[model samples]
Target: MDANDFVEIDGSYLEGGGQALRNALSLSCILGKPVRVVKIRANRPNPGLSHQHLHGLDLLRDITNADVVGNVLLSTKVEFTPRTILDNTYRVDTRTAASITLIYQMALPVLLFAGRSSRLIVSGGTNVAFAPPVEYMQQVLLPNLKRFGAGFELKVQQYGFYPRGKGTCQLDVQPVAKLNAGQFMDFGRINLVSGVGFCAGRLPVNIAIDMQQTAQREIHRLWPEQECTIETVKHSPEKTRDNGAGILMTANTTGGVVLGASALGKKRIDGHVLGSEASCQLAEYMRKEICVDDYMQDQLIIYMALAVGRSRMRTGRLTKHTRTAIHVAEQMTGVKFDVTVEPGGQTLVTCEGLGQLNKLI
Candidate 1:
């Protein structure tokens, strides 16, 4: 490879977290640009690739036919050179409780621009800490991504929890030529709220119902006139690898606005409290003038750079993760993000997309 063939990204920049490496690899795979990132996750307590990060990297390498160096757990640096994007069914198992959602999120973009459609059967934790659950991915992210003319279907085969995680899910994606700009700037009235509360393994099914009941009552307290509903999913031990419980809640507006929040049950945490917090968080998000939630804003920044026209997203606050995503996208592709904060406390992020084409297609 020539000296200038690939760009070196400092993983310690801005957020200095796993997202930098994930976004860098995703962009590298899509744009077919080689990348070398050093000091991966330099600021975290465990400042290197863990099982979770390694799982995503290996998948990226395989799908893009990339020559990757320093691919291992605890690796602090990586060099990736992608030759092409190939469509195929891949089975990836983290074996541990590493988040499958994180892996799917990073891989979806690369697969979206592949020469053909792809299918993934991934195993790991579905509802984990510090990552989006499968429910949120299905209910929130997928619908939001549809605005850009790219979509996928995810079906969970089994619920995976922490510790002895080996949960499974399937993702089916179809390749598309170009993505349209998404303008999610209008905040609307939320008339309906829905949620799924689930428990798997040794936990009792009623605990899941309790989580649902608590969340529903809390949301009703906030908006008495609104319609709120929650359902419980009882997963047998045969359907799960270990014991776990969690709730995923979403608020939908009559004007096409959707906001989601989730809470994972922990050994020390109370499910009722978790449920209350999830509902309260959704309510708090609605109170803001912003249309996009924090996590969705972080994820959408990448697509904004890849779309055809000027993509815009209005959000209330900017996270370091979002800023790092912008930096990585700008460095990897020929796109710039313009962020304008209005007096109403809403920040509009606008980007003139690269409208990248999959040459293989």
Candidate 2:
């Protein structure tokens, strides 16, 4: 293919982070467009592609039989040319505490149009800093995606933590001809706030229970009438266990709105503080009456561009990450996204979707 056929993207766009690379490549795969990204992660202390980023790129290349250049550590520029989306069992092992959910997010959109069912196995961090935990995917993202007719199953075989990462997860994706546009604007009553406090590093189980108690107390304080419950999950008491601890709290509204907030344990941060902060964050989002959480706003941008008909939804704020996704999608697929702040401060995003059908299906 000629160089003119490629969608040239500046990796140092607004966010200037890994997200720009992920969104650009995902849209390129589905649209059958080659992409050339430059100056990747230019704003971070460690500029250029990290191991985590490279793994995602490699997986995408393999899944689509794409030719990739600069699939290496600390590379600043890369080009990807996808041939076709294929179905197979793919695996990736980061061998570090790299964020696995980030990798999964990068590859999932492209898989939605696979010719047949596919299974992806990834090993790395399940819960880590600067990335959404696996629970968020399970409780929040999957539910919202289901509403759009993009259904999949994720089974976490082992939960890995930072420094000693070894978590494993299986993601099953089935082909869909088209995605139904999203219309998530209703803000109904909340039914319950539930959570799972996890204990890692063979820490005492009470460490998790304490966080649960603190989270519940904070939740009641923020939403006096809201019901709350929590449970604890942990690994066996082995010295070789992955080292980490955290709590993932979620809320479900009568309208089926799912929001998640989480905090990982640290040496300086107390468990009470972690739980309290997570609870407060979730409660704050609930009070806003927004259909989707802040992070989901960015995540939904790609699907909105690809879904049939017009897609509109109310989200917390228009994060720079969301804006980056929107820019990349428009550039890659020639889709338009409308973003405006609502009267009550929430942002309403709308898009005239490409309505691109899955050729495989």
CA RMSD of each candidate after superposition: 1.3, 1.4
Candidate 1 local lDDT, 89-130, one digit each (tens): 999999988899999988999999988889999999888888
Clashing pairs in 1: none
Error of 1 at 277 (Å): 1.1
lDDT of 2 by residue, 1-361 (tens): 7889889999899999998999999888899889999999998999999989999999999989999988899999999999999889999999998999999998898899998999999999888888999888988899999878997899888888877678888999888899999888887989889998878765777778888999999888877777899888666744237667888898898887888888888655467787887888888898898888877888889899999999989888788899899998999889899888978999889998999899997
Please give the clash total of every predicted structure, in order: 0, 0
Cα deviation in Å at residue 250, candidate 1?
Answer: 0.4
Q: lDDT, candidate 1, residue 162?
A: 77
- What's the TM-score of every candidate structure? 0.97, 0.97
- In candidate 1, how many Å is residue 63 off? 0.9
